[model samples]
Target: MPDHAISGWAVVLGQLAYLLSGTFPDGPLAGAALTLWMAVLGCAGATVLGVGVAVLLDQAPAPLARAIRALLAGLRAIPVLMLIFWAYFLLPMLAGVHVGEVQTVVLALALIGAAYTAQVMEAGFAAIGQGQRNAALALGMTPLQALWLVVLPRTLRAMLPSLGNVWVSLAKDTSLAYIVGVVELSTVATQVNGRSVGYAAQVFAAVALLYFFICVWIESVAALLLAATRSRQRRPLWRYVTLTAFRLARTPARPPPTSASRGSSRSRPAPP
Candidate 1:
């Protein structure tokens, strides 16, 4: 058996590094950087909007919750590509406004991500027994306080792994932005392949590995957050920030001295 000598690895590594770190000649982030920006914004928006929607749904009247649920279900059913087209094309026309390609792509991804994440969050929220929040309320906690400190913490832990998956999915979906002319990792890889000539498979494989590593890191961070959030449920920390703010606001202001008292004090001090 002959030992295979690895050849041309340096070129592959150089291309991957360039793809991951290079900026466009026009000074904008290119390749992986742009893709990362899109992913973080899309996933962050999704997490916030998804959690907010789920909370609103849980707290809403039965009929209203049902309506919201149906609406989200319908939105989630729509394909992501169509959402991109809708945002990139129809949205500007409907609103009589122009939006940048990057903004449109991120908005479309966020909307779809929010819809899917909302479903995951709703299920997590539902799994929580009401007895806990009810107990907090009985012990003088406001509904909002109980929800924030008690209900939300537990519910979030239940959903963190799932939410992490959504984040991973959102990052990969940034490739769809190519149709709208937003240059990101996958599009940039294609462009580089077209220009470089050969090593196309290797470049794409590098892109895949980058995505895989990023998703792994995201899940690891999510796991840590999940653990921290779980601990917060055991020892509620939300009140500390509010209490600190309350203490700061309660600080005593200086009182004004009366003119008569000031004159009398001056005279007495002179005698002394």
Candidate 2:
């Protein structure tokens, strides 16, 4: 092995950086972009689908909810590799549609992530007390309103840590995108090794660090955003938008105008 491969760690780091520059001559995206892209898409779609499944499970009749739960459990039981194969090989046959390798990887991640996410979400929901819904009802809030304002917020609060964990897992799982020929981090690392024979350890070790730092970067950003929202309480971008939406849906109840009543009495009852 060359001394550059042994002692020149800086050279290795630089090569790693170049590999992850997220662009190459052939296309606009390479390893880093493609990896993070799949992670983002998978996490987003999973969150939405998981929440939807959770809601359905919560609202459906007993028999129906049990069926939904069974379905989710079945999904969770299936290996992610099988899910990927289904997306890549079986989905087109079933849906009569064609999606690229990128979409296939993302779809598999989302399908599996959603099942896991729903499991955590249901546990979060279970942690919540039913009395909260009653309290909202007592306060004249509709079921949907109570769900929107109270139940969901608390359930999400409980789910946040688990959701973060799931996100990290999905981010790392993007390495599996290589199986479908997606040019992600693992794929790039393999290519680099093919070129620099006998230094597979150095190339792959740097790639491993790259994955670690990418996940850490994502977690740092998420923590910062979470802190911002928590500190602001009602002033951050998401809060402002959610509050505005609720206000538009229905204004908070206000007492009748006491100033108007007082002014009308003074104008009409000068003799009294």
Candidate 3:
């Protein structure tokens, strides 16, 4: 390659490196580090809250279930940006506490993510069928035991792909944190673009590539986790019992033989 071409490529790489680092050692959190921090913590919070809410929604009384469903629906209806704004402006007043910009974004992301996660989990639970739990009950297991052993394992296994999608989406959505003045990756890229003349396309391309790679990494990890989950062949005692009972229930019953048919079989045997 020509020396000029090599120098141009080096300049592009240097710009990207500057954008990603963004005075990390000298200033407030910014760039790729901030983005990843928010995404990981936000998704973690979402998973825990979402899974818990799903279980509660499944087991709650009729009125409570309706209320929880309505709340989740409302959260889903709101945009992530709006949620961040609310968290940034309204939450402090409501709670009478000082919430940092970073914390606000993380909380907003978590709420929206949890709402989606709950819905996903609800679908997963529905796919599992009530029969699974009933089978556990019939085999002398308590409701909690049945849920923990028989129903949850199957539901999680079935929902693994969807949950992975949710994580990836949440990770991308962390960009919205810029609304709250959190200097994450996108913001740093924009700042770098403004300072560097005639390099907007390259700067933004770097940002896009960063996001692309992050999402790809998340998906790859999720796929590995899913494969591991599926490869697990060991079944707990409760699971084994419930599965056996379930299969037995689904098996078709044989009709009783008529007296004439029985007698015909006896005579036929003697003739043979």
Question: Model 3, range 1-272, lDDT digits (tens) per residue?
Answer: 47755554466688765567678677776888778788888888998999999999888999999999999999999999999998899877999887899999889888998999999999998899999999989977778768877787888889988988988999999888888788889888878767766666667777888888888878887898778668758655666886687678767899999999998888785544
Estimate, for each residue in 1-272, the C-alpha lDDT of model 1 and write its tens digit.
Answer: 12211232445676775587556665677788888888888988998898899888878999999999898888888888888888888977899888888988888888888888889988886788879988978866678767877788778888898999999898888888888887788887887778666556666777888788767777887899888876835554566776455556757777899999899888785544
Runs in model 3 deviating more than 4 A are 1-9, 233-272
- Reference-based TM-score, model 2: 0.83
Better of 2 and 3 by lDDT: 3
The prediction achieving the highest lDDT against the true structure is 3
- TM-score comparison, 2 vs 3, better candidate: 2
The better candidate by TM-score, 1 or 2, is 2
Residue runs of model 2 more than 4 Å from their true location after superposition: 1-14, 21-25, 232-272
Q: Distance (Å) between predicted and true CA of 83, model 2?
A: 0.8
CA lDDT of each prediction against the hidden true structure: 0.80, 0.79, 0.84
Q: What are the TM-scores, per candidate, against the unseen true structure?
A: 0.81, 0.83, 0.81
lDDT of 2 by residue, 179-252 (tens): 77888888887777786676777887888888888788777766765565456345646646866686666766
